[model samples]
Target: MIGDSGAKSLSEGMTSMHELTHLDLSHNNIGHTGAERLSEVMRSMDGLMFLDLSLNKIGDNGAECLSEGMRSMHGLTHLDLSHINIEDSAAARLSDVMRSMDGLTHLDLSHNNIVDCGAKSLSEVMRSMHGLTHLDLSHNNIGDSGAKSLREGMRSMHGLTHLDISDNKIGDSGAESLSEVMRSMDGLTHLDLSHNNIGDSGA
Candidate 1:
């Protein structure tokens, strides 16, 4: 668990001599500078398979830097970036990274301020990433339009098994869109849509 202070040392580009397989830097207040520093070292760890930077203050700029770093990281299998302020542009950059990440199995982008455009960008990436099994988009402000875009993209993703879109403002239209995805995605075993505004009308 790399905390805020631990993140600062990483900002100095201290590369581990040994092959690091996993790095968890969640719940840190390290902003863009620290994230940029982390991105610089990502290229050195060729054996890294998992990276968690959840609940950080890394905004769009930080996300862009990390996405740029990911262009060279082909071994990453799991990536958690929940609760970051990665907006539409950052999401777009990450989408491009996802296209090349053939080993990515789990991706979490929940609790961000992503809107419809960001959702669309991610959906485009999802269409090509067939290895991803888990996806979480809870607490984002993705409304019906975003949900629709996700559904269209998910139609081709037969490997995804778990998905969470709870606590969002998705209304009846969004629920309908998700229902379509549920129908098409037979591999999915768990789905959460609690606290959404998909009332009786959608059911």
Candidate 2:
């Protein structure tokens, strides 16, 4: 449930990918090559719910392949890809997927190097995502503009409960942006802003 070697065995058990509901391939070395194989396997598994691929080497190319597979995964609820080293374009592709995937409730992208552009793309996704309850974007390069984008995009979102933006270089401006979001977001319960460079003026 936490590692990758065990996930490989589970992948092998997926003969037709029908009974598989959850798949956690986190901390694995499943780069582009492995993602290619995963895409093939996911084609038949339309019943997947929770998929965790955090701490892996799934870069932009691998993420793109995964997004291709995600088109068929209509049952996916939670998707974790923390520290997966995805670039802006890859995150944009994933954002496109999130735009249409209404079943996803939790999305984790912490520790990845998704920059401001990536955050912008995710903002686009947030506009269309109606079921997302938790979203993690910690340790990225999201700054004030990205924070503003998130706040603006989340205006229409009514399901978000938890928002994590820790370890980013967000300034007081970003904090104020999030405060604005908090004003409109009555559903948010847990908001993590630890390790950021926010000032007292944010409150």
Q: What TM-score would every model get versus the actual structure?
A: 0.91, 0.90
**Candidate 2 off by > 4 Å:** 1-15
Tens-digit lDDT track of model 1 for 1-203: 45445666865545753377888888878688778878887767767788888989999999998887677778889999998888889989999887878888899999898889999998888887778899899888888999999998788778889999988778999889878878877888988998888889777
Q: After superposition, how far is residue 52 of candidate 2 from its true place, in Å?
A: 0.9
Supply every candidate's count of residue pairs whose N, Cα or C atoms clash at under 3 angstroms.
Answer: 0, 0
Global lDDT of each candidate: 0.84, 0.82
Candidate 1, which segments miss by more than 4 Å at Cα?
1-8, 11-13, 16-18
For model 2, residues 1-203, the per-residue Cα lDDT tens digits are 32344445555667566888988777777777677667767878788899998888879998998888778788889999898899889999988877667788998999988877888998887887778899899999888888888887787778789988999988899888878767877888998998888888875
Ten contiguous residues minimizing lDDT sum, candidate 2? 1-10
Error of 1 at 200 (Å): 1.8
